[model samples]
Structure formats: structure tokens, C-alpha cells
Target: MRFIRYVLRALNPKTAVTMDSRQVFRIRRCVVAGVIAVLVIAMVSCGVYGVKMHAQRAAQASQSATSTDKTTAKRQNSKKESSGKQSQKSQDNADTEDSVQAELKNQSASLTDDQRNEILAKAQQTARDNGHEPTQYTYCVAQKGDVGSLDDFANAVYRILNGERGWSRAGATFVQGADGNCDFNIVLSEARYMTTFSPDCSTEYSCRVDENVIINDDRWNGGTNDWLSAGGDMARYRVMVINHEVGHRLGHTDNETTCAGAGQLAPLMQEQSMHLDGCATNEYPLDGELWIK
Candidate 1:
């Protein structure tokens, strides 16, 4: 009330008028209420703005965290995929190796030392009994990749060449080993390795490529149908193969001759492996005409 009276006095100092005290008091109350209302509104606006800004920051932080998690997951997934591919490649390589080993095991054959020694002994004895001048040859039995025993093959070749009814009758002889000058090389090779000697010859047949008497491993293991049909004698076929190839080495050409008679022996120069026709199988040079003059 005193403050209102002072304000009123300052405003109307010159005019000394009679005013109601209640009206002055009502004016002062209205002014005070207006001021208080403005202050409350300012404080509420500041608090609302602050809360909005804090919410925005929190939302932004949450979005950033979500993006970071996604990036980490992508990286982890990529690593797992790369590791899986490498593991598959390693497994594939291991499988391929195992397959190769199995194939080799199936194709290979084994030969013993005792069997080789016996074959060598028999071949040497046969050479001595054939009554021919000693001719020298280098005999080597080879295989491509672990196919069979070299010793047994070498002995078989020696036995074939030194047989009583074979080249011995032609006065040609063979000395074992490469120490002496070799007239020719008798190579007993596996079927897979036959191409090394005679590139044009098939594994089903024997050939004389240059000075090499290339005998096929397949034919050595299995006899020809013609010989089997006649007597089922593998020995006879073995003898025939030896004579045929050796004949080529001794300047005998492919005769392609048939049997003169139905019961006669087939010519030694004939391709008996193909067919015997009506003739019996012959392993030797008949009529004493094959001798070296």
C-alpha cells in the first residue's frame, strides 16, 4: 500500500487529487501478477528446450551404436566366409591325392629277388645249350612308375632269346650286361612305358624300334586269342612273340604268308598274333634256312 501510494504521488505530484486506496492496491496487485506469470513462462520454455536437445543427442548416439554393430557383424561374416573357402580347397586337394594313390596301387605289380635270380640262371643255361657263337646284347627290363619288378622281366627276356629253338639256331648269341659292346638292346617294358621305345606301336603288340626289342607288358601277361584257341598254351605264345621280334632284328621282313598246308606250321615271319588261319603255331625258323651265313 505504501509503495502504491508513493508511485501514485510521483505520477501526480502536481495534481493533488483524491484517489481510492483500494483501486491503487488493485493496480499494484495486477502488475505484480503479470511479472510473476512472465518469469514462470521463461523458466518453463528453457527447461523444455533443454529436454529436447538431450533427447536428440540420445537418439543420435543410439543410431551411431547400431551402425557400428552392423559394420562389426559384416566383418565377422566376411572372415568366416573366407575361412570356409580355404578349408574346402584343402579338402579337395586331399581327396585328389588319395585318388591318385589308389590308382597307382591298382596298376602296380610286385616281383621277388629269388624269382629274378632263377630266371637269369635258366636264361644263361639255355644260351649255353643252344650251341651258337656268343653274341652280345644289353638286356634291360624297365617300368614306368612302379608297374612291376625289373629283375623278373629281364630274366624272361633273356630266357626267350636264349631258348634252344629260338635265335640260337641262327648262330646268333647274346652276352648279358652293358660292359661289352652291345649288338642290340632287348628292352622289356611295361605297357604304359612301351611308347618310350616305339611311339607308333600299340600296347597290345610287340615292336622292334631301332635296336630296341620292345615287348609289351600286356601281351606278356595275357596270351593271344589265336594261341589260346589252338591249345590254350601261353608258353607257345611267349615263344612266338620272341621269335617274331627277333626276326625283325635279324633282317626278316613282315612275310604275311599263310600256311602252305592245313596242318603245316605257320611261318615264323608271319603276323601270327592277328590270326593263325589253318596253320599250327611255330616258334622256330624251320628248314635250317634261318642260319647266319
Candidate 2:
């Protein structure tokens, strides 16, 4: 510092020839002092700048460390979630497999002999009752020998129980044809009709279970069976068959619709008079239980 100040002062003649030799020396001293002040200011500025740069670096490092910790925590959490989902999926699959296995073990294809009979009997009874029985429902089949019996019976059956109240509100009106013939008519397509089994099952057929049995015609064209073939039951033919079929309306299947048929035959919901294979409403004891309460 002294060397610098001396060089600066030596160049100034005015400074060398001061008011006093002492003053000249003072000028040189002042220059030296100024130089020292400048040096001191530079050192202080450098120290302050170094401190600020170090603080900035430290803050950056801290931020980076914090960011790294957050990244690691997120990765661990994602891994844990993935593991939990895999475990849950495996458990659900196991449950589904167990359910399928359990279901597979419960069913068999073969039916018991009793069960077969039950099915047949149930079908016959259901079909007949659904076709023939009305509370006071009647089907007009004239004397057994009449060829037009089917027509008359169809009429009565339709008139009484073809619409809604075939069983409750339905009633049959028997009308006699010119040649001692009969016909049963059905007004509604949905009305039930009665006929004998196809020898595969000898007796019951059809039920008039609905309250709305309606007849739209004076002729009996639907519901054909063999009872009309054998001329036998006489006037009872109409009533007996009606009764047997009605038994189904009261809810018994083939096991129940019985009266009597050819050769000491038990009448079921059979066109009773012709084959003596069945009975009419009068043949079966009228049960109050048969009426819908």
C-alpha cells in the first residue's frame, strides 16, 4: 500500500511543494491512508459476497435433499398400494373359485320314480282343471251318443269360463241341438277345455281355472278327444265329464279326477258318460273347499 501511494504522489509537483515540507509529507500520508481505506473496503465487500454465495448454495442443497426425500416416500407408498391391490385381487379370485365349485357339487341329472309320476300327474291335473272347472261352471255335452256333444260342451265351457271369471263368475248353459247333439263353445282364446288323455295317460285333460271363461260361438270345434267315439254314458255324459274336469278347477291332478270308466273304471276328469272313464260335477261330492273363498 505504501508503494502505491508513493508512486501516485511522486507524479504531483504541487503536492511535493506544499505550504510546508511537513504539509507535503502529510499529503503523501493522506494518499497512503486513502489507498488503505480502498483496500479495506474491497476486502469487506469480498467477505460479504462470499457469505451470501455460501448461504445460497446451502439453501439449494437443503431444497434438493427435501425433494429427494419426497420422491422416495412417494415411490414406497405406490409400491405398498400395488401390493395391497394384488392381494385383494387374489382373494376375490379364490372366493369365485370356491363359489363355482360349491354350485357344481349340488346338482344331479337323474330324477326319482316317484318324482316322474308326480310330474305326470301334476301335468294332467293342471291341464284339466285349467280347462274344465268353473265354480258352478258347466259344459253342455248332451246324451253320450250325441255326435254334437263336443260342440255343445264347447259352447257351455266358453260361455261360462272363457274370459276372466271362468271359475268364479262363469256359468254354462246347455242347449240341445236338433239331432240330440251337443257343442261346447269358447269365447276367449285363453279359455281352458276338457278332453280325455291320449291312452298314454287315460283320463284327465284341461282345466278352466280362470274366472273369465268366454264363449263366442254356438258351435264346439276345439278340444278333441276319443270319449266322443264310444257311445255309452247317455245324458250323464255331459254332466259327468264336466264334473271330472272341474275337479281340476278345484285343484286335484290326475291322481284325483276320478269317477269311473269302462269296466268298473274310476272316473277322473273324464268325458265320463261316453267311456264311463270319468265323472261329472254331480258325481264328485261338492266341496266348499273347492270354491275360492
Each prediction's number of clashing residue pairs: 2, 71
lDDT per residue for candidate 1 within 1-293, as digits (tens), equals 98767666644635324556666566657767978999999999999999999999999999999899999899998999898999999998788657644543432324365654564455555545655554544544444545466655555555666565666656655535664346666666677777766568877777888777777767766868876776534555666787788778787766645567777888888777777777887877764435542
lDDT of 2 by residue, 99-196 (tens): 64443232212335564345334433443554534223233332222233344344333332322222322222122223323233222221122222
Candidate 1: residue 50 Cα off by (Å): 99
Give the worst 10-residue stretch by lDDT in candidate 2.
211-220
lDDT of each: 0.66, 0.42
> TM-scores of the models, in the given order?
0.50, 0.31
Q: Report how far off residue 102 is in candidate 1 (Å).
A: 32
Give the poorly placed runs of model 1, Cα more than 4 Å off.
1-138, 144-146, 179-181, 192-196, 256-258
